[model samples]
Every structure is written in structure tokens, then in C-alpha cells.
Target: MQSTVNYLWHTDDLLGQGATASVYKARNKKSGELVAVKVFNTASYLRPHEVQVREFEVLRKLNHQNIVKLFAVEETGGSRQKVLVMEYCSSGSLLSVLESPENAFGLPEEEFLVVLRCVVAGMNHLRENGIVHRDIKPGNIMRLMGEEGQSIYKLTDFGAARELDDDEKFVSVYGTEEYLHPDMYERAVLRKPQQKTFGVTVDLWSIGVTLYHAATGSLPFIPFGGPRRNKEMMYRITTEKPAGAIAGAQRRENGPLEWSYSLPVTCRLSVGLQTQLVPILANILEVEQAKCWGFDQFFAETSDILQRVVVHVFSLSQAVLHHVYIHAHNTIAIFLEAVYEQTQVAPQHQEYLFEGHLCILEPSLSAQHIAHTTTSSPLTLLSTASETPKGLAFRDPAQDIPKFFPKVDLQSDYTTSKVRGGAGGSNHKTPQISQKPARLSQRCHTPNVVVGLCLPIPQPCPFSVLPWRFSSVSGTPEIEEVKRVTELKSRLRALAEALSRCSHRITETQLRLSNLSSELLKNRDQVHADRSIQKIQCCLDKMNLIYKQFKKSKMRPGLGYNEEQIHKLDKVNFSRLAKRLLKVFQEKCVQKYQTSLVTHGMWMREVHETRNHLRMVSCSMAAHNTEAQGVQESLSKILDRLSNQLLQDRAKEAQVSPSPAAPYPSPALTDLVFHMQELCNEMKLLAFDLQDNNRIIEGLNTPPSGS
Candidate 1:
């Protein structure tokens, strides 16, 4: 029979081909949106109706952002084949992306994080929506590219999806060979023997395999060939050692040359990227499902790594853009050579001023006399003086010379002088000439003097061109004091919160204790009632045995004697029997009397012990009750103190305003208050029940008298 479809869309361009279906790029005429049409071949071994029904049942209920959307399904006319219309992804499958030259065999670490996050997000969506994509691989995932260079990943292939129901059992072995779970492969290998039940963990296993393949561009485990050959692989997967162990074993067997690299791509990544990437990949590809991180956990970790990468890249770009060089020493000196040179003064004058010493040179003074003068007075002069017959003549001197010359104060201009005739003198006359004392100021040349300025350097202004100068002034001490106070306040708040939580937990524990006491009382009552019933049953059995003996005696009749003879014989026998019975009864009475005495003694002892135990329990209960009451009162007082403290802190905080803002109460406080209230209610209920139980127990102990 020829099937008919509405022909909503058609495309001649084949997008991809799977095992049972061929996908084509098409456009929905009504919606005018591009869509992928997946056509199932009717000529395949699978029954068309069964496949369509199964696919429809799963796809109709699935609704998630990550899972592919199924728009419509129809039967085509000529081939009688079922077709699925799905959303068309523009960027195509992840498999194609990984295989592309742009990605270079595998994605870079940063881009890998992005792709991994997408995959995990999709898997998490599927998990949350009670669906497990049994075949989660790069080929089954499509990435849609937006105009802003953003990508959206969608998980496709609903034909392998299954619902997550606790009671439901899945036995069908269907999935790609490369991504099949060990359990599924086991079931397939043992198909003729017995069927095995597997849960959604199989999907996790498959996801692990898919993640391994995605990361390394190769499967973690590979079979030789075919289903029978795959059995050996499954056994290896289930029973053999891990990948690390296998690699180690291979190395041991071949002495390291067996695993040696033949070329550069023998190991796809460099030594460093591999060391970091391999462990991360191993965590996702763990054989144990429970040990492996779930979709959400994986995505959360992956997103964190991605954020770290983004921050790192941003930091690198910032470094490159700013291109600032930092130096420990002052480089500003290179730009201010003129200013620095202006500050440089001669060191000789500085030494003279600081050391309080001077040097002088006179033409007539000898070197020995100059050294002697330096030893006597610190102002030393090295010069030579010419002596005439009557007086000494001096060279040119300034007007202020005489005022500073203390030694020459006695010498006056009217003093007798001697004229020297060293050059040419026709008549040698004794002319007296007075020699002027050397002035202290004439000892040193003042023109060559240098003075060192000791003035402090001017600080840079706020708006100055100095790079290290601050733009605004701050009261640092005040800010620090405020921060310290804030920290103290936060710690106090935390302490109060902790105290409140402890009080709540104590109340809850008290409530639970009271409930347990009540339950213990009820159990004791039931045990007592059951014991009484057992005793009554034993008594009834004894009475039944006595009645059966009486019935047996009444059925016997005299066989061989007259009435008088029988009566006399019966009387004689009765007398003898009465005597023997009396003796036996007396023995029994004595035995019973002894037994009663022992029983009475035991009962008295039991009563005394019970009384003592009850007293001890009462005392203990009283002590415990007192302690609990004290604790409750103490907690109430502590809570009140905390409340008062909190109010005072709030007031103090309000008075001394914060720079930014005061932190608000944590949202956890509301939950704490609610829990505290609930605990108080529960404690009240438990206390009432405990009181009732104590009363019931008291009543059970007090027996009725004169019954």
C-alpha cells in the first residue's frame, strides 16, 4: 500500500545519513523556517510502524532546550516511509567541527571547555526531563550559530531516548558500537541465554565513552571487529584493567618501544596540554558510573574552567594593550637631569662649613710654621714672608682685614718701620716698617665656597603630573577603624546565629526524646498485655486436660459384680483410694505451700527492686527535667541578650554611618527563625505526650486491691 503525506517540505540536498534514516535540509512552507527532514527507509529490516510508534512515544513527551525539537511526522507516499521534521542547525554537527581543519584534529583547551559545557548542559537537560539520550556522541549533537558568533548546541536522535521510570525495564540492545555500554554489549553477547535488565546508568556509561572520544578523537576502548569479536572487548571492558594499567602493561611487555611515538601526531597534543587534559578527560571517562561526575557537575566544573580561561585571556589582552614597563628604581630622574644638576653643589665649601676648618697660603711663611699653625688653631696657612732690616712689608689687603685680625690689634700705623734694601739702595738707612696681622677671613677664598642646601623636597600635588601621586586624600585611619568595627559586628552576628541554631537543635532533640519515651511506654503496655494473654492460654489448656480425664472415668461400667457387692467394693476401694489420695493431696499441698512461699519471696524482691528502679528513674528524670529547664531558661536569656546586643549594634551602626552601606541580615536568618519556631511547636507537643505516657505508666504500676 502507498502511504500519503501532506508534503509540508521537501529537499533534494542530503545533510547526513544514519544507520536507518537519511536527513535532508528542508524548509517548512507554512512557517517559512529552515528544518531538517529525517526520512526512515522503509526497506530496512526494522518494522516501520513499530519504529514510528516508539520514536513518537519518546519525542512527544520530551521538552528541553538542549534536546532537538520535533515539529511534525508524516508518511511519504511512494516508499511508505516515516519522516521526522526537526529544527535545522546552521553550524552543523560537533563531529564535523572536530574533524575540520579549523579545529586541527581536536579543539583547543579553551574552546574544548565551551564545547564541553554545551554538551554537559544538553545532557543535564535531558536528565532533568526524565530522558536519557542513550547515544550521546558528537555525531548526535548539532551546533547552531547565531549572528553574534554565539553557538547553541542541541542533542538530537530521539530514536534512542528512554524514559526514566524506576519500575520500567529496558532490555533492547540498540546503540552505536563505539559508544555502547559494557552491560548492553554483555546482554547482546548473551542474547540467546537470558535477558538482563539495565537502568539509566547505561546512558551514563555511553556518555563517558562519548566524552572520551570527544576529548581524544579516539575511543577509549576499541574492538577488533563484529559482534562476536565485540564480546571479547566487552569482557576486557568489564574484567580487564584500566587504560593507565593497560598502557603500563604494554610498556612492560615491549620495554617502552612498543608505545614509542612514530610521528609528531602519535600523541595529538604537546606534553604540557596533554598532562592537564588527560586527567580531566579521565575523570569524565571513569568506568564506575557513581564515581563519574553527572551532567550538572561536569557542566558546572567546565563552566568554571571556561570562566578562568576567559579571565586569563582578558588579563593577557590587557597586558598587551597597556604595554607599561614597571621598574623598581626611579626612572623619572632620566627626564629631570637639569633639575638634578641644579641641586648639585661643590663639596669643598660644604666640608669647610661642616668640619669648621680653613686653608690659607702666605708667600713668606714656611711649610713647617704652617703645619705648626694648623696643629695650634684649625685655620692653617702655608705661605712665605720676606723680612727687611727694620720692618716687614705686606702685599695688598682689604679694608675689613684689621677688624678680624685680633693678634694685630696692638699694631698701629705710627709704629717704627724698617726699610728693606734688597733690590737697589744707594744709602742704606734703617727705616722701621710694621707688619699687619693676617685676617681670619683672608685664610680661605670665599668665591670658591659651595653651600649644601638642607631644605625638604616639596611633595607632589593631587592634580600634579606625577604618576604615583594620589588623586584624592583619604582618612585612612578612620576607614580602618570603621572596617574593624564592621568586622566585629559581623562576627557578633555570626555568633548569635550559631547560638540560635544550637538552641533550635536542643529543642528538637528534647522533642525527639519525649516522643521516644512515649513510644517506649506504649511498647511496654503491649508487652504486658501479650504476657497476660499467654498465661490465660496456658491455664485454659490445663483445665481442658482435667475435663478429659473426668469424661473417661464416667464412661467405665461395672462388668462382673452385683449392685450391693459393687457398692461395698466401690466403698472399700473409695476409702482406700481416699486415704492414698489424701496422702498425695497433703504432699501436693506441702509442695504448693513451699512453692507459694518462694513465689511470695520472689514477688516481694521483685516489688522492692521495681520500687528502687522506679525511684532511680524518677530521680534521673527529675534531674534531666531540671537540667533541660535550666538549659531552656539559659537559652532564653542568651537569646534576649543577643537581641539586646543586636539592637545596640544596630543603633551604633546607625549613629556612625558606614562609607558604602551596612550589610543586611543574611537570608539564612529567616529560615533559622522558621526552624526555631517549628522546633518549639514540636517540643511542646512532645512534652505533652511524655506527660501523658508517664501518667499511663503510673496507672499500670498501681494494681487494684480487694478484687
Candidate 2:
């Protein structure tokens, strides 16, 4: 069917083709993200309208990690075409892996089990919602690559799936011949009674077959490819046990799991997996549909797998399943009381059954209720108008409850049959479950099986026996207080690392500010030295001028040849070499003052940068900020003292020489030197105070010992 979808999706090359749809590698135009597009040739479908609509209804309702997500749907009116935009699985389907010649050596058991559990988890969710994927085969299961050498498997191809009402059954068999349940095949192909149909348990049979094939590298049953041979194969599926087919069927190492009456089986499952799996296969592959393990039962029993399939239950209604995993052995009554209080149900009339049937009140005898994954404990509870039931129960063992095997301890003889299997070969079927479905019937209104899984806890069940029943582990418990505490510790360490980064930044800011303040002090001291040099130069100039006057007095009528004047001039005059030294010192002092001014500006820039950063780190860090303020106040006081001293020095200079051109006499020069020395002493004290401030800042910058 040719059509254009929304401008948002850009269709690319075809990825793969299926029976009713063609999958393409596409990109979301808005996000540039890759996605898989399943385009349906609605005109070519067996029940085109029903298939298209049913898939849409089913995908929209389901939301799970193991279930393929349906992002959007598109349809074109003219061409009878429909599109399903979904999450892309790059690695393709499990069927492809099993069939590929490259994987003839077989997949690692670890990788295989992980993928198996993921598929089971998704199937459990499907069963809970009353939906069944009638066609669950290797081809229908897709594998997606995940983080760190892990892979996730999700159930796809819901075209053959449907959600049945409690009274409904899948009488129309529409899947591969090898994967179909015996009951479904008999009714559709053999034209058995239409009323005789199967429930969701059909999917369980397929799961058992799929897992068996994945592990053993061969199907448990012999293939009857043509129409004439199909009848013989169907009979075998109905009568032959899985143990028989596996013992006498075909084998291959690097090809499709081909099995025929003419070949021998090559078992790929490890002993540990075989011990657990063989019994499961024997039970699930049972001819009587009701005798096999239900989907929920399979999930619960497989808990002891290498990759434990943790029970995760989700609900759309307000009904919440709060898990209370108790380690210590306790009375069932305490747990019930706690649940009753938590849900705020009335306290006066509270009657609970520890191990009995659970019934949900309904108008019809065939309406299906929600499915729950129950523990090995056969406990059940009857549903009421209020979902918060008074109690839970276990089935009466005398009648029959499909039993769960104890943890498969496969260290020694895995080939040895399980407890029930070794019980003298009597019909290994649970009579109660085989009787009828767990609907609101007159006789079996509340059966042993619970419909949905919620609040699933494992082993040594606290809700199995009577209110006063105790567990085997009273002192030492089964459940841990907390599993994987190391993960939590790592998160805390990440938080600590973030805090350290913040502290380091603050320390760096404070250090820069301290360095700037120290540099500013050095500049102020350089200015002081420059002023001293200028005062001494002024003294030398005064002496030179007086010496010139003494020499020029020779032309003066009376004072030209006066010995007294010459003697006085010689006593005050400085040597030529000494004068040259003074001139060079003054020039050096000028350069020093100029360099200090530039440095002082740089110090100001550094302070400005610190001020900008301080806004972020300006938390009232108790001791550090307060100490910084104290140092600032001390610096302010020193600046004030220096300002006063400078003003005093200016007054002294004005008083010592009233005229700018007048030379200072001996007494005046001595007074000027003494005053300048006093000013320099005060400036030296300011420098010392700046050094003290630097030390204080250093103490504040040091990190706490504990940190």
C-alpha cells in the first residue's frame, strides 16, 4: 500500500518483512531519533479490520519494559494502509538468532536464560491484563541490546493476540502448527466442538516449547510438515509427554531446532537448568490443558533461576500493592491487621482465611477478574466491593493444587525426577484446577488460583497458614533487611564528592583575594620609599645651590675673597660622586613608584574578580566570613592611620619651608628628616598588619582535618 505519513516521520530502507506487515528503519524528523515502523497491508490481512484495531487497542493499554512500546499510529484513507511506530530493536528477533548459520555453536546459557526471563516477565503482564498472545514463538520475540553487555527481550507481533472476557475462548487457532496448543489445534483443524476452547494457558504451552527449543537446540516434538503428517504430529502433541519426544527426536548444533521422529535430540541445557526445566517441560507440555502450569505459576516457580525473574506488578486503578517483605517469622494475623489499618477499612468485623479461595463479586458467572502472581503458598482471598480484602489463603492440599517444586538443588542427580514426578507415575495432574476456570461459578466461585500478581514476595510465605502460623526461620530470617546496600553507599559517596568540589572552589577564591591584598600592601610600601628618596634629593639640591652662591661671591665687592664664606660652603657641600649616586637613586625610586602603581591596578582587578565570585560562595560560613570581616576592619584602621600620618608630613613640609624657592638651613633639614622618619615608622607598622591579615586568610583557607 502506497501512502505518505505525517511529515514528522522520515521513512528509510526496509529492515525486514513479516506475514502481514513490512518493518522499516525510520527516523523521527523532529528529534532525528531512529524508530521502527510496522506498515500493515490491511487489505491483505485475514481479518484486516479486526487485526488492525485489536493490535492498536492492545498496544495502547500495555506499558512495560519487556513489552514493545507503540509510540504512534497512522492510517491512510485511500489505500487501506496503517502504520505502527515503535521502539527499534537493532539485534532483530530470537528466531533469526536461532536460525542463523553463524550461531550454530549455540548461545551461552547465561545469555539465553536472561533473555528467557525477560520474555516471561512480559508474558506475565499480558496474562494479568486478560490478553493472550496466541502466537508466542521464537519469531514473535524480539531482542534489544542494552547497557554493559546485557540484552532485553520483548514480546511483539500482537496481531494474533486478543483480550478475552471471562466466558470467551480462543477456538479459532491462528498460529504456527508447531507452536499451537493441542486443544486449539483440535478445535480449528480437526473441527472439534466450537464450545470446547482454551484460555490464556495456551500461551504457557508455547512458552514451554520456545524455552525448551532455545535450551536444547531442538524441539521436543517431531515435525509433520505436510497436511497428511500434521494429523500424526497433532496426536503426538496431545498424547506424548515432553520427556518422550525429547528422548527420541532430532538434533543439530548450528541450525534451526529441527526435530523429527527420524532424528535424535541434542540437549544443550546445563544440568542445573535441565533439572529445573525438565520437570517444568513435563508439566507444561501435559496434554490436559488445565494440568499444565498457568502463566503466573511458571513465573513464580522460576524464581530460583540464574537470573532471578523478580515479580514486578503494575496497575492502572487506585488499587496499590504495597510490598511488605518481612525477614523475621511472624503471625499472618499481624500482617493482615497492618494491611487493614493501612487501607483504613472498618475494624469491627474482620474475618480472614489464611489458606482459602479468593472470590471477586460479579453479576455474571464468567467475568474474568484481575490476575495476580501468587507464591508457592496456596493462599487465596475473595474480592469484595472494597479491594482491600480482609485476608489471603492457600488451596486445600487434599483436593489438588498444582504444586511448585522446591528449589532445584541440581548439584548431584539432575536426571532424577522431581518429588511429584517420582510419586509412582500416578496421573501427575492437580484435580481442582482441571475441574473448571476460576470464575464466579456456582460450585467453584473461588478456586485456588489468583487472577493477578501484586505485592509478590518470595519463600517461607508469611500469609500461607492460619493467623498464628509460624515460619521455619523465626530466629534467622529468609528475607534480607536490605539487598544491594553497596549501591546506596555509592550514591552517598557521589554526593560527598560534589560537596568537596564546591569547597575547593571557595578555597581557591579566598586564596586569590589574600594574594591580592598582600600585593596591595607592597605597593603602598613602595610609595613610602619613593617619598623618602624625593625628600633627600630636595636636601642635596639646597646644598648645591648654596655652594654656587659661595663661588659667585668672588665678583661681590666685599665677600668675593672671604675665607669664612668658603669654609661654611665646603662643610655643607656633598662630593660630585655622591651627588651622582643620589641622582641615580632618585631615578630608580621614580621607576619603582611607576611599577608599583601598575601592580596596584592589577591587585584592584583581582579584588574585583573575587567580589564577583564571592556572591556565589557568600553563604554565612560561620567562622571564615566573620574572620574575613575582622581583617577588613583592621586594614581599614591601618589605612586611616596612614592617611593621618601623610597629612602630618605635608604640614611639616609647609612649616619647615614657608617659601618654595628657599633653601633649608642645617636646623630645618634635621627637623624635616626626623618628621619623615616618624611617618615611615607608621607606614612600616601598616605593612606588618597586612602580613598578619595574610596569615589569617591562610588559616581560613586550610581545609578542616575531618574533611
**Tens digit of per-residue lDDT, candidate 1, span 341-369:** 22121222111111123222222333232
lDDT digits (tens) for residues 1-707 of candidate 2? 23335413334467666678887877775667778778876544666567668988999999999998999897644664778888888888887666432122234456677767888789878877889888898887888988875788889878888997434666667776666777777666676675767777788778877876676444556433423355654444455554333322322322233423211122333333444566666667766776776665677766545332211111101112222221123343443443344344332222212223322222222212222233222112222222322111222222221122233222111111211111111111111111111111111111121111111111111111112112222332111111111222233233334334444665665455455545545555444444444444454445345434433443344433455455444433433323443444336543453354344334334433443333333332333334434433543444455356446656777688665542224343344334334433433343343334334334322322321
**Candidate 1 weakest ten by summed lDDT:** 312-321
Model 2, residue 707: distance off in Å is 36
In candidate 1, which residue ranges exceed 4 Å CA deviation?
Answer: 1-12, 30-32, 43-51, 78-80, 102-104, 166-169, 189-195, 222-239, 243-284, 288-310, 313-707
Candidate 1: C-alpha RMSD to true structure equals 55.7
Q: Against the true structure, candidate 2 has what lDDT? A: 0.47
Q: Which ten residues in a row have the lowest lDDT in candidate 2?
A: 452-461
RMSD per prediction, one decimal?
55.7, 42.7
